[model samples]
Target: MAPSKGRGGRRRPARPHAHYARHGPQPGLSRLHRAPPPDDAERLHHVGPPVPHPTAHRDPADLCRGQLGAEWHPDFHPREDELVMRQHWSSSGFANTDLDFMLKQHHIRKILLIGMRANTCVDTTARFGQELGYHVTLIRDAIASFSWEEMTATFELNAPLYAHAILTTDEFVDIVNDGAGKGSP
Candidate 1:
């Protein structure tokens, strides 16, 4: 059966699991199974400066200030009036962050995700959001990755599995505008 149109009259596409199967496992999978090259092994073993445990000895505020400038304590790049949600973990914006509480406060059940490292950060966050019961949408064209493979893995392979909807930036804007009405600021 043909997919039904959404409230905005946009038809969602079929999941592309077959496309993922055509492509092999993501590059990271092979790297994980293989031994490191000799040069990398040497560098790995080399006694450089002792690495500090992430959260063992440092105050959270101090760590934030040290990692980011005092003026910009969080890693996010937000516009003047935009809300910023900071995340420490690679997966899940809600993990170790106030995102869940903030969303609940705002009564926001749906999320539109767009960011860098499509296969890594974006994919991880999308999956986690779906698992947490939020309706997750991905702005496909707005996101990017270091390579085509990575982008494909996230957008084609993982997003259909986790995200409730995938749309282009224009599509998203149109839906928002339609819902908000022409006079909305």
Candidate 2:
């Protein structure tokens, strides 16, 4: 007897079009092929005002690039027009980054967090956001994790204790569209 077809019965054929080839660079080509080396101004723009380090005299960009090397540096590059901020200490966004300052500057009293590793970075950031007096909302369905158990733990235990609200992506979007404005926080 033959096995019945199920959801994973067959694989679909690969698309004929090369998406990147049509839109941008060809496959196996370096994205930075035509990019210029980091100049003084570019470095300053990315790294922000120098913090007091043991080697305060050395350029922070040079130091970071030297320590991290070329491959790692490329991974840290922000997309065009994206605001990149550095975080140095705990998993909390506000602990070492300028997130608190930015929030205060923009008068943002609430934050919506969605990201990878629900148990670690997301949870920590949400906790810190609450501690910092912001109304923190975790978009539960939008987060990811390696283990179902970890996801369950975050959503069930830790998130309820730390976060002001736990919402699915659709629920959160609906609320926003229904005129729950920014000032709702």
Candidate 3:
């Protein structure tokens, strides 16, 4: 939580809340608009083995080696040092997972989010990250929404307010390199 503005306009940290508020008491169709992702499901409507689109099958795992537990990229990139590129459904980001411990170990101060489905897991994780005090930047190119409209609308209504919607991978890499972005080791 951010602190109240002082008479001099100095900023301060807000006292931690005893508990975070739920978006709403119950999920409605609008809830689907912000639903969490399903990681264990054996299906991906667009990108996994089930997709009919040829290019869509380009293995996400191959492009995302860090999340797959592979060696870091040879580029010696700085974002590679701090930014975590993870599948929303993977055990990596779950509450009980080692992610929190890993972040602490690495002294991560902020998170720049990049992945699929802006409305589901992406949204949930961003919300969770904010509650935990990690600034999240949702890379627009890196993320693929379930639908054009959903993605467009989400970016329109939420991205500016909740997280930054960066337009390219290059910009994201630059931020991480500059240390403006940080996350788990």
User: Which candidate should be chosen as best, given TM-score against the real structure?
Assistant: 1
Q: 1-185, model 3: which lDDT tens digit per residue?
A: 33455335633223221111112111121222122322211121111111111123456455344443234322222231244433334212434444545555556545555444456556666667667766566655445554656565555555656663433444444534454324311
Off by over 4 Å in 3: 1-92, 164-167, 174-185
Residue ranges of candidate 2 with Cα displaced over 4 Å: 1-82, 180-185
Candidate 3 structure, TM-score to reference: 0.45
Error of 3 at 5 (Å): 32
In the range 55-90, model 2's lDDT, one tens digit per residue, is 223454543534532122243344564345553443
Tens digits of per-residue lDDT, candidate 1, 29-70, equal 223223221222222211111111123235545435345322
| Clashes per candidate, residues 3 or more apart or on different chains | 0, 0, 2
Worst 10 residues of 3 by lDDT: 44-53
